[model samples]
Target: GVTAITAVSPAISARQEDTAVAVANVVMFGTLAMLAYPYLAHHILAADSHRIGMFLGLAVHDTSQAIGSALTYSNVYSDEVVLKVAAITKLSRNLCLAAVVPWLTYLNVRAETKDDEGKEEELEGKKSAGGKSVLAYVPPFVAGVCAMAVL
Candidate 1:
């Protein structure tokens, strides 16, 4: 989406730094959540076991991170369940991505149109007032790119 936005509107390129920052924050939080999940799982059971920890990690962790979690439980548990859960979870998220990207593209285009209208109004106001025209900070166009990248 971001890429599409950049392709459509070069001005959005200026927001790449903000996009990177937002992505970094999300990844950092997601990693912390992945690491903390095992601890949370431990308290949910009668007795903590490494196998159960691995299960939670494998089942709940992000698709990319599930590999290590699956390997952790490989010798102790069947690989089938881990693979199934990982694939299903990843598949489900992928399906969501497929649907969401186009919807977001529509939304971004709509927003840009509305913003253009608003900017035109603002420019008119400034012209009438004999003041300098000012440009507002518009969000980056990489929403589509970000959506695609997540998938």
Candidate 2:
């Protein structure tokens, strides 16, 4: 959820209202996941610390929430493996953000640009004037993300 908001916000070309609603949904669902994951791990996934950890790491929307859920589960069940596994899994998932964010941003920008182009063609009967280059559509933060991923 935090990744969605932080990584996607700058690349989003949607109206502020739409972005706000999306952010709100992310936060709401993430909160719910944080609250519910521990109990689900305990009852539904009994005696499987690794599965519980993987489920929490993959299912939770935020890194902190995943780790917190694992910690809560650990304390409740008196098992420390869940915490270790969850942290590793969550951090591994987080590393993908560098690649995923830029790709998602590019796709979003391309889709919006295509829609705009089609609309302009219908109205003007020609290619849009002063159209942005492909390079221009690339988000600025992509380079930094790639650099950090390399490091």
Q: Rate the local accuracy (lDDT) of all candidates.
A: 0.43, 0.72
lDDT tens digits, residue span 30-103, model 2: 78888888897778987699999888888987788888888888998899999999888887777776667656
Give the per-residue lDDT of model 1 (tens digit) for 1-151: 2222333232332376676655565456546655655345444643235445445544543455554444344334444454455445544544454344445544444344445346522335422222322122222333443565677
Compared with the true structure, model 2 gives a TM-score of: 0.71
Give the residue spans of candidate 1 off by over 4 A. 1-14, 42-62, 70-80, 115-151
- Best prediction by TM-score: 2
Number of the top lDDT candidate: 2
Give Cα distance to truth, residue 134, candidate 1, Å.
27
- TM-score of each prediction: 0.47, 0.71
Clashing pairs in 2: none
Residue 57, candidate 1: alpha-carbon lDDT? 42
